[model samples]
Target: MEVGSTRSWDELLPDALGLIFKNLPLQELLTVVPTVCKSWGKAVMGPYCWQEIDIEEWSNRSEPGSVERMLRMLIARSNGSIHKLCVSGLQNEPVFSLIAENARSLRILCLPQSNMSDSIVEKIAGSLSMITFLDLSYCYKISARSLEAIGKNCKLLEGLRRNMHPLIMEERLSQDNEEAHAIATTMPNLKRLETAYLRYINTIGALEIIHSCPQLEYLDLRGCWQVKLDGEYLKDKFPKLKVLGPYVVDRYERNNDYEDWSDFSDSLYDYESSDDENRFGELEFRFYQQFNEDATNGWPPSP
Candidate 1:
C-alpha cells in the first residue's frame, strides 16, 4: 500500500510470496505485479492460485472490454480444475461461451447477468456433468427449452436458481396452454430451486417445476405473481423443501411501459434472508456495492 510495504514485499520468500500476492487486489494482482519480475510473474500465474475465478463485480462500465477479456484469463487459469465462479452483469457473448465450454470442471456456476440461451446451456450441461450449484437470476431471455436442456443434462445438479426480469422476457413465454410436465421430467436432481419474475407463466409451469424438482430443500418464488400458490400444494409436492419464500414486488413495469410507472427503492437484497447470516461474502458485497442501484426501466417484476 505504501513505499515501505512495497520494499517489504520485495523481501518475501516463495512461501510468503503468495500471501503478498493474495493481499493485493484482483486487478492489481493480475496486472501490475507481473511487470515487476519474471519470478513474480511465474509465481503469480500458477494453477493453485487460479483454481477459482470470481468476477463478482462489473461496476467499472467504462472498460467493459477489460472485464470481458478476463474470461480468457479465467478459462486459461482454470485448466480443468475450476470449482466455482460468480460472474454478474456481463454483456459479452464470448465470455458466456468460454465459461460454458472450458469450465467443464466446475462444480458451481453463478452467472446472474449472462444473456445466454438454451444452446449455450446445453453445451454447459453436456460438458460439465459434475455441476451441482447453478444460478442464472436476472437473465430473462432464457426459455423453458433451455430449462429443459439444463434438467436433462445436469444429472448431479443439487441447487438451481433461474430468475428473470419478467418484463424483459415477457415476449419469450406467453402461453398459458403449454405443457409443463415435459420440462419437469428433465430436471429431477434439484435439491434447491429459486425462481422469480414469473408473471407470464401459469400454474402448469409452476406445477411442472415443483413436481419435477422434488429434491428441493429450499424453494424461493419471490415475485411469482401469475402462479396460484398454496401451502397445501407445496407441502404435498415438495415434502423435503424446508424453506419456501414466494413474493410479489409492489412496483412493476409491464410491456416496456415505464412512462407512467413510479420507481421503487432498489435493494441488493431480494425477498428476505433465507440463510442464518447474510448470504453475501465480503468481496461480493464490495462488488455489488459499487453499482447495483440503477433504475431498471425494462426490468420485469417476475418471469
Candidate 2:
C-alpha cells in the first residue's frame, strides 16, 4: 500500500461499505454519509446499517412530524432487525408504537426528556423481550408501575437509568416509598443503575437494592438527598460495586459539604465560581460516558 497511491473508494464492495457504515454514529450515517453517492447510499441504507438508531440529539431541534417520518423511513430500512434505539424528544405515540412493532430485536431503549406512560412502557415490554439496557431519565410521567412492567417483562435487563426532574422529585419525596422496593424485589439481574434526583428513596431502599442485586457493579444515586450510606458498609455489602454520588463526595470534592442542589430547569450558570463549574463538568462527563458506554459500543446506538 503506497502512501501516494490513489485508491477508488467507489470501487469498494458493499460489505466493506457496510462495515464503514456500522462504525459511524447513527446521526452521521443517516444524515450525512448516505448523500455521498448512489453506491454509498445503497450500502449505507441497508438494514445492517440501521441496526442501531439514535436520534436523541434531534430532540427539540426538529418538528415531531419530521422526526416521525424519518424514524418511519429508517424502520422500513431496518427490516425488523434494529437492536438499539434512542429518541429523546419525539413524543408521538403512534411513532413509538411503530418502533415497538418493527424493532423486535431491540436490546437497548432510551427515551430521556420525553413523555412516557404506563401504556407506552407496557407496549415496549410486550414487544421487546431481549432488552438489557433502558434509559428513561427526565421522563417525568413514568411511574413505579412502568418500572415494574419492565422488571417483569425484560428479564434480561441489566442496566436502568430513571433520573427525574428535581421539582418532580421533590413532589414525590413522600409518595415513592415503595418504588425502590419494587426494583429490589423484581429486578434481580440489574448490574448498572442510575436513580439520580430521587428524593423519595431512603436508606432502607438503598440498602435493599445493595443487598438484593448482588451482581450490581455500578450505581449512581446522585441528587438523591434522602438516601444515606456509610461508605464502609456499602463497600462490605457489595464488594464488586462502584457507587457514585453523595456517598463518594469525599473522594471527589474539596469541600464535601458543598452539594450540587440544582433545579431541573436551571443550567450551571448559577454556580458561584469556575472551580465549581469545572468540578461539575468532570462529574457530568464521567457520568455521561458511563451512561452511554453500553449503547455507544459498536453493537448499540448511544442514546
Question: Per-model C-alpha lDDT, please?
Answer: 0.58, 0.67
What CA root-mean-square deviation does each model show from the true structure? Answer: 9.3, 10.1
Candidate 1 lDDT, tens digit per residue, 62-174? 25566667767766865766777767666766667677677667877777766677666666567667777777766655666766677677787777766555445456555
Pairs that collide in candidate 1 are: 166-300, 166-302, 167-300, 197-302, 197-303, 198-302, 198-303, 223-247
Candidate 1 Cα deviation (angstroms), residue 16? 9.1
> What TM-score does candidate 1 get on C-alpha atoms?
0.68
Cα-based lDDT at residue 217, candidate 2:
76
> Over the stretch 91-197, how does candidate 2's per-residue lDDT look in tens digits?
76787788778857888787777666878887777776788888887777777788888889888888888765444455676675576887898799988777866
